[model samples]
Target chain A: MTPHDDTQQAQTRAAQEPIAISERELTVMTAHLEEAHQATLPVMHDAIADWDERLRSENDPAELAEMRARFGRPSRRGFLIGAGATLGGLVLAACSSSDGKKSSGPATTNTKAAAGGGLATDLKIAALAAALENTAVATYQAGINAATAGKLGTVPPAIVTFATTVQQQHKDHAAAWNAIITGAGKPAVTGVDTTVNDGVVQPAFAQVTDVAGLAKLALSLEDAAGATYLSVIPVVSDPGGVKTVATIQPVEMQHAAILNFVLGQYPVPNAFAKTDGARTLTDKIG
Target chain B: MTIDEQELAELTSRSRDVHNDAMRETREPLSEIVEVGREHRAHDEIDPLAGREFAKQRNLQLGKRVGLLGGVGIGAALLGLFDQPAFADKPSDIQMLQTSASIEVLAIAAYTAVLGLPFAGSLPAVVQTFVTTTKDQHMQHLQAFNAAATALGGKAQSMADPVLAKVVEAAKPGLTGPGPVLDLAIELENTAAETYVANTGALEDENAKKVTASIMGVEAQHVSVLLAVQALLSGGLVDQIALPPPNLSALPAAAGGVGFPNAFYKTDLARAADEGAVK
Candidate 1:
């Protein structure tokens, strides 16, 4: 007999000998079951416990209220346990419908929802990302022009070489983003968005012209660009686009770190990039 | 019209079958939800519960059969949960963090040994400064990883002395001058960067991934500076102007350089080596 036939026979045999569980023992059995569940899924237990702690400690009235509304009150362990039991019931129903025959196919389907927004939002985000890259290109160009014109007084030649290399990378990034946007049939942005240049870049440049100043400006630009990519990754509709952004973001952070080192700071300052609370892509482009 | 004993037994058996079936269907989705919950909890973010409502609805439909089965269904469900893939694997996050901490420990030991080398004192002041600063950073990283691991209920891992010995021994062949020493530093930084990148995706905790990536960014920067220093020491920048520039002349000819080496960072070298991917 085939393995499938064996499985069918075993399932049929099991179905005939149902355990007669008394209703009075249900609670005790459930407690045992919950214990087994926790032992089996300790990571999940820890996660749920962590969430519970957060919910209890949340101080903001509005945020606390929101959490309560979404997840119910913080002290709802009993309710959660009940929910788990209910879910088990549902699984049993499904199994019964299939006559207790488990499919030999792959167990889990991809659960990720389709990208968060529509194509238009994707285009907007892509354009904004492209704009940030363009600004980086332009900023680097401006720095290079200053160095060539001898405006960066006493800046080392090696520093100029470094800036030139970094500038080329920004150009590559800009081109890549433009390709992504144009490939989507969106009108490619023609030039660097001066909004970021005016608001952040120029002001930064006006404050410093030496190698130190240039490094500072470059660092800020890289930080902001990195932050923007990070902010957009979760919101972008295209999985490919999200992957692209994730790939690019590390490079930007790398640039920031190198610049930090150039300015006589620790290369790895923080354990995580300060991507939160930074300007968004829209904020930068506008 | 009274039900016979056979009929009652058959009814009970059918109810048990339904209960068992529902238990089977619920396991996979619940496990997924738990995984998502773990990730969100790590990040201190809200659980999205994107697919949770469907599971709930399915359970609600089976509510009557569930009532009949009493705690039997719960017992079966727990059994199913135990069989889930998420539970099947060992807790990888703590293990990964412990591994990372051990790597950091290795780094600290290697750097400390390098500093203690006879020729190290005569190296350029900038080189000395770089070595000390980097070593301090590794020490900090080691402490941080240990703290994180401990907080996660995992034991802190110390640097494997044998691994450190092996690394130092490997560098002995090139210890003749500062040039070789710098090259070795570059190699170590690249490996660290590649390891962090490769392992970042395997991390179950979002915060752990972020921490790893942040360290990776630093490692990449270290590679860049080390490459630049190597170029300077080699008399002049040869082939440094190429877009994405060539890897440091010290590195193998096939290796890519400091200028954003690849569109996507290559990962898994360190991990693969650790898992005996290397002969």
Candidate 2:
């Protein structure tokens, strides 16, 4: 860091004042800063400056465009990140800034950050979780609908049941999260324009034909969903919330087993452990 | 200054217009964007190892925002297939379907090659059935991938990586023997499962997630089948049915649901680990 670098850095920081810092940088900064709770804005501004420079210099124009489309929204990603940091009190002031536009000024303390703590009150995390669940539900329903529409074979009753049931569970989870957000008196998540477009879903549905393929697809989805929930569960504060997520989590494993069973892949001859095992701890902490 | 109710309302109205203008001018529909990926060349000398390294470089270039929206993992996966630009983007549902199909093709090649192993001659009836069924599923997976990709106007690659497919073909006879072939099969199955698992998080499209899940299920069965064959070879009790191993259960629920933990870990580190024997 030369004096020139420092001056450039300062100028860059000034320019990035209002833009949100990304999650990765927030993590790094969170580790670097002692969480004194002051001077947080500088770190975010610096991150934004760096992010803007990087995006400007990126070789892949398409990727950059995608980012602009997805994260350019001001509060969607940025506010969500702020909410996440504040709720956890982790000082990782991640600003996801979904709207692509850069905000002006140095980072300013906001009411959302002031409202941090407890599982129920954390609007950011709740909103994110709800959004994620809603997306999954929407995605799965779309997949099922597309699969049925393909008419390759009779959409097995079991396949229909699995997709519908799991989707319902996701819906319920989203509702529960919404309830929590409401109880906290925060606005529930307002969705983005990223609807479950049929163009995306129809092709995935085309990948399977028989009951086994359908079962297999369902099992894989549940596994992914289950893993996502598991990764977040430890970070979540509400025991009730944790339990709710956990209960939903195992259903994914069970779904995997059911698919395996249908495909004649189930139960170890020697072991009693339910197959379709969840990811191990070493998989994460390692 | 914070946008108060009135300012906020005014800005919101204005922002919509800006967004509309932007959309009209800059929004390339997904189909067009996907075409860019599809039309991109598969670099002749590219390997998964090189691909992974390329991703690391790209992510480094991407800066802090790398992990913000959906995170850097997708970037990493995209990098893994550096040779295949089509597979590199934050995989769409159609892309996922293609990848899953590619994996199935890989699995079929792997399983079919395994049959030529001397070990195949000595396998028990049940174990053989497992292998046979796994091969069948891979074929099914191939069909699924083709149908999905073709439907979406994307051509599914014959096999995602030619080197791995060639290796499977070349290694078939030698791998026919029990210890080496079984281990190789197990490793291949794990690798495929890991690939699907990794893709689960990397993809943003809902359809992609579903397709990735379908591939994962196939991989799990491959695991089950391989495990049964291994158990049978060892004269150990085989499972009543092949089942997906519980490797992902250990991850806490936040990162991924428990079932998908670190599915990307080994793939993420495979080259450094000298684990890319598939080549």
Candidate with best TM-score: 1
**Model 2 — interface RMS deviation?**
22.5
Residue runs of model 2 more than 4 Å from their true location after superposition: A1-286, B1-99, B116-121, B228-232, B235-279
B164-207 per-residue lDDT for model 2 (tens digits): 44545555556536667776676666556545544444443333
Give the docking tier of candidate 1: incorrect
Q: Each model: TM-score of chain B? A: 0.56, 0.52
Tens digit per residue, CA lDDT, model 1, A70-149: 22212211110012211100000112122211121111000012112444444445555666676776676666656555
Tell the DockQ for candidate 1.
0.05
lDDT string, candidate 2, A115-227, tens digits: 23333123344554555555556555445544444543544332343455455556655665556544443445433112111222235546766545655555555554454
The best candidate by DockQ is 1
Instruction: Score chain A of model 2 by TM-score against the reference chain A.
Output: 0.45
* lDDT value, residue A194 of candidate 2: 25
User: Scored by CA lDDT, what does every candidate get?
Assistant: 0.48, 0.40
Task: Give the range of the ten consecutive residues with the poorest summed lDDT in model 1 chain A.
Answer: A85-94
Q: Which stretches of candidate 1 lie over 4 Å from their true place?
A: A1-126, A153-156, A182-195, A206-212, A227-243, A257-272, A282-286, B1-88, B146-155, B159-168, B202-204, B236-264, B268-270, B273-279
DockQ-derived CAPRI band for the predicted complex in model 2:
incorrect
